[model samples]
Target: MPVLIPTLVFRPVSTQLLVTDGVRSVGENIRDALRTHQDTKTLGCHVHEPIRPYWPEDAAAQSDRIFTGRYNGRRFALNVTGGTTLMALGARRAAAEHNVPLLYVDTDNGVIITLAPDGSVTGEREITVSVPTSTYLAAHSATVSAREPWGKAIERRESWLKPFLEAATVLGQAGGGSERLLDVIRPVCSGGAAGPAELPEVTTAEESLANRLQEFGMIEVARRGGSLQVQPKGDERIRQFLTGHWLELYVYRACLTSGLFDDVCLSVDIRRRTESGTVVNECDVLTTLRGRLAVISCKTARLDHKDENKGAVYELDSLLQAELMGLYARKVLVTNRLALRPPLRNRAGLSQIECIWGPHLPDVAQRIQSCLLPGRR
Candidate 1:
């Protein structure tokens, strides 16, 4: 009997019944994202969709039909966290009838609350599942194209990365020099570098910008009397950075070095196709912290109209749309070399957007890191 033996290991199978509504792709996208999740893939478990967007009575009936059909014997839990109020009401009816546990997600606090089948709170559970950036986007029915060249090089280019951060610091400390420099140099460097004869005469603030970058070895500058000359060094990337690309890199590098985020992307192009046409949303920096989505917008040039910063504020606030990234996303607007006055701050605050401006922008990396330490959060 001890000569030979055969063994088998069987893991429990987990299944989910997703409830969607007539709203849009919100429910479909969530189901699709979950179907593509790492666990469901590895375990070879299948995702089945039997219920579609329907009225309250139809929704409850469909749920009941499925429960009494093939999945009758399987243990179940109902998540009433999302979907339309009617859909939730129908799901609640089915849950009560089927005697399944109910759940509500507390997104801000990062926990899932359990409830009795009748819908009263029972207890809370931590969010254990991990969601990737792509999955998060897919959950919102948005897809991300390839990232910019700067993104691929973020973690690999420490030598260049360090200097860029240092230069950004100098930009903030140099008073209004950073903006003047970006505004002037961006156009000159964008379509290839312009001839020296075509360079604009430097204003006092602009001249300070040129001088500070010179000290950081980013460029060589010569001033004769009141005339200013800028000789950009290094590769074409250097010129690209001067053309408002540096601010993106600055904010990205700060997030990357903070080590607080699990995934960091720089200059992501988000596209969503609709009946009208394809819409594009260009983001400066996109990251995820504890499975939550964050969109950071960087501004090197003034985008205000009539000295009102509402233009920039609205652009950042638009990410909350359901067709875009959704309301759960964290929005941040970081301005380099320019101070965000009280009006801008108050406007951003109203939208729950974090505004990091001027010199304060330079300390973001440290701030994020500090929150990671024990008792700091």
Candidate 2:
């Protein structure tokens, strides 16, 4: 039977230490460990030629043995310098080249050491000693402390698993409108991080759940300023929201309609008085028929999925918004998304406001045509 090889792990202390101070500090830590446990005797460490005989000239030299330290009869090897760029690669290369007993690796420190048959490192390199596989294994094991050598590995695995559950919760809470999902995602989406190419692994499930919320409609995503935005293939509202050039289309369609005016002009900030005695400044889709002025206020909402009552809430808000619109002018809400409010089901009789709902282009164009028909006036 083949012997099951013990997995090698790099200690987090050394990993963090290496990132902060290079490999030299890791070597020192190993040396301290040896002196605390090993008996008294002569100590020597075989380090890369660049590390030996430290001098000012050697400061810029690639010191291969930044972590090599002598402590009692045992020797500790730490690789500090060359690890800046080619870290584990350098150590692995060194092991392959030399027939020494391979052991623990301090990937952060960039150190490789030879060991004896019994997995002990005496005072010398592998040249004179009969290096054993166990020795290499021991060296590898030494890089991690016995306290919790596997902690980082477990943490890494956990980091990758959190996103799924979080995504499900965020999506379920969405109430079925893409726009609501976008609203939740907008606050969290940093154009800096969520690129199309690489979404990062989130630490907690909640963070992952937020990312899942990102795959909503383009108009909603665009409204929120997200980088990884997507929309339905025929979603024209997304096109209008992104381009900001569709107000003219709304104005032109209103001209031939009879609902309120004959002479139509898009008002920038037309003011009107409401039934509740509040004055509101609004954009007026205006027209003059029989020398009377009429107005329409446009309010739009993209969809947000998961909140079934989202439409009802939106309908209520739209009514309130229309009352605000009615304060100064008649109101019309043109939305590509399905009408969320049940009370506003038919545009035929909803107080004094009109709700236009259509999905595809022809349907939307017709709805706009219906809202703007001059006969209604």
Candidate 3:
């Protein structure tokens, strides 16, 4: 928890890094990342020339040189939190030689701690700076290729989308084969893309749900005795919403209105270049809170503990690892199910991922706030 640097007027040694790198490519990426960080450009940060050193001895020498050779007489502080042990040792030696202050970010409490020349706590200040999703991903060595904004059109439709979600809750609890029907209907709505479809046989629950959806203008349905044929409304976005995107929009709205998150993005596509090849990931809903990444995966479809939902469970768990959002990320899997099956809940629990169901989604923001600020009520 020693990597978050907030840009504050009164702080330890002003915010910036004299980046150290064993690999020049990685060092350049770091510099680029900081240069493009949300606040770095506007608020300003001091970016020193990169120090390339492979060995501890070299690390100490070059790090010292960065301060002494060029910027003599200017006050300096050494930050040793992010780099390797060898680098930290080198940095410590350099700090001692120059008699400069040392500092590291305290990620756990979202604070920065500065050490005096004696290594005692000189000052610690809370970090109130916010980082966007792109900056967060870049810190983990990923780049955002593309992302979809939460549109104003969607905002205008929130009131219109409410009834269908309410009906979703009621029909979700209905007995009979409604879940299977929903699985079919969603694809049909997506596949048709505002076109007509002859739906498969639906039960009383499904028929009721479909009819309610039709009344909500989600689709157009004509009843022919026992069979049902459907057509989506003209709007493609609305069709997408009817096909499980509603959950994502609802969750996004919850976070936005909550005013707790630093940044929230929907449908974010990320790319990370690796030695093997280019790696890619897409987040349904991505956010940063309390100096930690939080990824929320939304599901309007039914989920049960049995291997049926195992892929979804593991995919969400995977996002919490270093390959993606990093181990420090807060992971949450959200579902329209009023309550998930016990085993599924336990599976998510093993990864410490919080699951929010339809009934409790009204408080999703509160739940996120609680996770980010666990000490608070």
TM-score of every model versus the real structure = 0.73, 0.27, 0.74
Residue 80 lDDT, candidate 2, scale 0-100 = 28
Local accuracy of candidate 1 as per-residue lDDT tens digits, 271-323: 76566997888887777654466677777776454354787788877766644
Per candidate, the number of residue pairs that clash is 0, 48, 0
lDDT of 1: 0.63
Tens-place lDDT digits, model 3, residues 1-377: 24435333233333445565444444445445565664454443455556654457766876677667556777777777776777677777887888988777767666778898667888887766676777767766787643443333343454654564454444434422344545556766666433456556656766777787777777777776776777767677666766677667667767876799988776666787778998777778777765677788888766763775787788777656754455457888877675688888888888787887756776777777677662321
Identify the leading candidate in terms of lDDT: 3
- Number of clashing residue pairs, candidate 3: 0
| Model 3 quality (TM-score) | 0.74
Worst 10 residues of 3 by lDDT: 6-15
CA RMSD, predictions in order: 8.2, 29.9, 5.7
Worst 10 residues of 1 by lDDT: 1-10
Q: What residue runs in model 1 are displaced by over 4 Å at the alpha carbon?
A: 1-21, 42-56, 152-217, 222-230, 303-310, 346-352, 365-377
